[model samples]
Target: MSKTVVAVFSSRGRAEQAVSSLREAGFNKEISIAAKGEDHKGGRGNTDYFGATMAADAGDGLSDGVAAGGLLGGLAGLAVGAGALVVPGIGPLIAAGPIAGMLSGAATGGIAGGLVDWGIPEAEGRQYEEDVKQGRILVSVQASDNKADEAASILKSQGADRVKTH
Candidate 1:
């Protein structure tokens, strides 16, 4: 697996820029973006999220043809496969790309849960979720350890907050 780098931004615009910069910097791996449930332009009740009801499951692989919500509509250009979703800890959220695709199989938890699965601390994952709840946009990418440092630097220069690596 590749080293992972996460960058949080106060706005979707900045997050998008970071994605672009990371892409430009040759960190062309899977990039995932997530935003608050309220930041999107539509309702959570809509049939746009990847819907799979589960009483409990750690995480499953994604199945295709799931409903992607309005939260992902605007992020389509930036995040590879943007979609709106609801995980356990995180209420309603917008997500994009392979990370979200992997989450397409998740049922028991939210973004925080996914972060935990990826080795991020539980407390830090929760904090990341809270940041999203506050209208921050999150961008995550997997690269070589050295490249992750470069990605973090790129995000910092682009005004990314909460730059983290794992």
Candidate 2:
């Protein structure tokens, strides 16, 4: 199965730089960057924005979709919760097959319809909301399991401060 990985950088410039390095490292098509931070007044603005953005982006891994079932989910949840107090939201729920199936059923009704209409569960939805509230940026990548490790390694080599693999 294909998995997603996220790399968090300290600044937009660093993030962009990492992207460039990642590309050179052979992960050109698999990397992305998001600038996170709060808008504020004067010099405080820059600091607040960078801090908020980092928290938000870093906290994203614990949300529902990113962390569903298995070890990855648990680790993501713990990491997010501990790092930023963000809860796992729809991301995790949708990733969890049972919850996703239930949400699909609630949305459409029939098993076939439910199967076709994928959705995350309520609990997970709530978790996503919490993650956002914490003010974090999110970077997502979809790649095969084997590629995930390499992608993460490339991001790290390129100076990604925090890299999460799922």
Q: What lDDT score goes with residue 32 in model 2?
A: 31
| Model 1 ranges with Cα > 4 A deviation | 39-73
In terms of lDDT, the best-performing candidate is: 1
Cα RMSDs of all predictions?
Answer: 5.7, 13.8
For each candidate, give its TM-score against the true structure.
0.74, 0.39
**Residue pairs of candidate 1 with colliding backbone atoms:** 48-67, 48-68, 48-69, 88-109, 88-110
lDDT of 1 by residue, 7-84 (tens): 888866677778888778775546888765442223333332223221122123332222332223444457577655
69-108: candidate 2 lDDT, tens digit per residue: 2132221221112111122222211112232223333433
Q: List lDDT for all candidates, in order.
A: 0.64, 0.37
Number of the top TM-score candidate: 1
Span of ten consecutive residues with least summed lDDT in model 2: 75-84
- Lowest-lDDT window of 10 residues in candidate 1? 49-58
